[model samples]
Target: MNGLSGMREENERLEGEVSRLRTELSQAAAGDGGGEKVNELLGEREAIQAKVEAMLDALAEIDPEIAAAVAG
Candidate 1:
């Protein structure tokens, strides 16, 4: 695959991971004594989201149309 396709796949994977982490975080919040776990999940999700944003930025620089399509 080319850079655009590779980045799109990576972005999709990262987004899926973020969604999973959100679910886990929600479950942890609903339980007792899961403060630490919740924090960890939040941090992980944030990092992954940041990575995705950076990748989008880079992709936008390379090809705005492809980036827009991937982002949507």
Candidate 2:
């Protein structure tokens, strides 16, 4: 039970972090920059976003209890 609760909390935290990263990426994308670092960050952000989404999907399929706990 404690483990499940901890997992739920971690999941929520990760979701929030991913949301912030997406927002940051969007803001950075709008800025005027022409460098490989910017391109790399954009790409990394996109990949991380996709992975986070995929993780959410997988968790949803794998555990109904955790999904309900983590979901709004």
TM-score leader: 1
| Candidate 2: clashing pairs of residues | none
Model 1 misplaced stretches (Cα beyond 4 Å):
64-72
- Please estimate how well model 2 matches the true structure, expressed as its whole-model Cα lDDT: 0.68
Worst 10 residues of 2 by lDDT: 1-10
TM-score, structure 1 vs. true:
0.80
Model 2, residue 32: C-alpha shift (Å): 1.0
Q: Residue 11 in candidate 1 has what lDDT?
A: 78
Q: What is the lDDT of candidate 1?
A: 0.86
Give the per-residue lDDT of model 2 (tens digit) for 1-72: 245466567668767876776676677677766345457767776776686666666677778975786597
Compared to the true structure, candidate 2 yields what TM-score? Answer: 0.50
Task: Give lDDT: candidate 2, residue 21.
Answer: 64
